[model samples]
Target: MALISDNDPIYELLDKWHEDDEYEKILEKVDEIPMEERSNKLWFRKISALNNLKRYDEAREEIAKLSPRCTETADIGRLFYMMGYIYDQKNCEFKAIECYRRRAEIDPSWDECDEWVNDSLGYAKKDMDRAYNAFSRFFPDYAEKNQNAAEKKTVEEPDILPYISAMGSSFMSSNLGVKLPLDQPFFKCSEEDKPKVVSFLTDRMHITDLKSLQQDFGRNRLAPLTSNILHIIETGEEPPLDKLNAQQLTHYEASKLLLGKMKEFIPEGGLAAWDYSDMLAIARFMYSVDMLTNTEIMQTYLFANDECKRLFKSWEEFTHSLTIGAFYNAFTRDTSYNINQSAKFAINVGLFCMQTYPGIEWLGEIKE
Candidate 1:
């Protein structure tokens, strides 16, 4: 085989730690290796990934591959312990306790094995009680099966899906701008006469009557992110730049109004998403909403690259009219987790304005 690249020394260090008793470090090293061909040390790497990623079955398959000629004095009891840890951490108490027993059986003389088996059994017993008490899917195996499904989807295509979309973490949190009830309740406000609520500032921080505190949190409007985007595409109402203060926007970057997208009216067709992206060129003038940089870059040169343009078009089609999803797709860092940004708010505001404005069609209802 060709001599391992200059990166071999790094991999060699990782290989040394791969089977070390430090389970967390072993996982770190496993992650350090690229996912493409982890099979070289695939056995241990898979073990570390599965245990941490909560794929117990796959981890077991990898552990099986790590076995030697036979279970001798060299007894891989430590590996068994890790398996137990994985199961127990996921609250599969019975399986965890069973694995612990198997580990102790393999190495009757090993002190670590004894301690591990005891500690794991303790956790298993407690979790078993709690599992009976609350009786919920807390032990969902913490299975990242949904994320794995998304990963599988992206691997099958050159057009990788944005991480936020795959993770289903829409970007609705970031745009609301200011805090409400941030002091006493950490952004929660209570009305003594009103009922309990799950989320405060349900859509945007608004002053509605406390009587409106129904189970729905009265979030009758589009998500802030969505409304904001619609606002941008339609009305061009930007965050008040005067609010940014003096130093933030200076002589070099003068305080100016937030620019909106310019759309051409096609008479019969109404308005089409302008293929020309002047929004990006006038980035300085346009409100730099969260993830605006990414969207700007994406929109700027996307059409120039044949593959990228096609992928974008496909994404646009997939997210057509679902402006919320599309804007979130680009604003998010990774789809696997929810983003706290509100870039979609501008889009929502834009679209809302467009629908309500003169000569614009209303496909959906606007509140009375």
Candidate 2:
């Protein structure tokens, strides 16, 4: 057999982790490898993962590090686009506009920037209206005096999604055998209310059972390392084993043992099996019950790459118009048992599903 390129496994695992939404793992795994083995593509992916995980502070610092090292126009375009996205999420209106404008200069056909531009403008209008309403209530002449001024002034909207999105820590806790309350609207609740809400849910959710579950879960202390081996199996790639430890070697051996079984679930068409509701249900159930191991989850991701893109071409398209079955499949695939995130993801997916399949309810327990 021909010799395997050292970079092959790096790209393969990177793609696998990206596909599975395991962002932090990408950085950790990359860091474990020698510095000389790193590349611009790896750095770009690290930045992308950080953004997706909502680590904006680290992502911005990384962007600074990558800016000088980058050479390709395509990489630069993606960098600017991601920077614009981070700015938008940070509620930096003008800065976001500037980044998006810069991105447009490079890739004019990028329509998401235009949509975000409009979103920023709409948010500005709402902020002005809200502020005026509050101030005018206290000062009657305030509205008349500042109506023109308000139109001229910039408006800033708080980053609602950051507060609302299911945080990674929540997932980690769930993975550690802390049974989360699926019915709780923790993510949707205001930041000030999350602590009290969580306290309330703790007793009500019966998380005391964690004492027993903890015995089997073992705190997942080795989870970080074990997870990497799982990714290797899922992506069907073999990294340099000489660099790994005894524990990781054991995990790798276990993953290989399960690889064949994992492939059985990944259908040829992957996400295109929209009509295959049975398969979707099977996948969801397997994930929920922990039957689909980490490697198996990767197998599905590997299988879905081309098909998912075809089904939901853009981030906007997927966010506003994903199918119910598809949403469940993605949500349960690798949540670390964080049902709140699963529920929140389902709600977002349902927004678009309702537009297409009016009043449709794919999940019996979870409603849009």
The most accurate candidate by TM-score is: 2
Which numbered prediction scores highest in lDDT against the true structure?
Answer: 2
RMSD of each candidate? Answer: 24.6, 25.6
Instruction: Report the C-alpha lDDT of model 2 over 286-356, residue by residue, as the tens digit.
Output: 33344455555334433333333444433222222223223333322433212234334534443423232
Tens-digit per-residue lDDT, 1-368, candidate 1: 23235454655665666455455666666666564535433444547656766677777776765665235543466676666677666544334545555665667676674576467546544533332222122112112232233322221121222211211112232332222211111122234312222222323323222223222222422233333444555665655556542223221111011111111101111111221121111221111222124544344333322322332332222222233232333323122111112233424433432232212111211122
The true-versus-predicted C-alpha distance at residue 295 of model 2, in Å, is 79
What's the TM-score of every candidate structure?
Answer: 0.26, 0.35
TM-score of 1: 0.26
Clashes of 1: 34
For model 1, what is the alpha-carbon lDDT of residue 299? 42
Number of backbone collisions per candidate, in order?
34, 0
Inter-residue clash pairs, candidate 2: none
Runs with alpha carbons beyond 4 Å of true place in candidate 2: 1-7, 109-111, 141-368
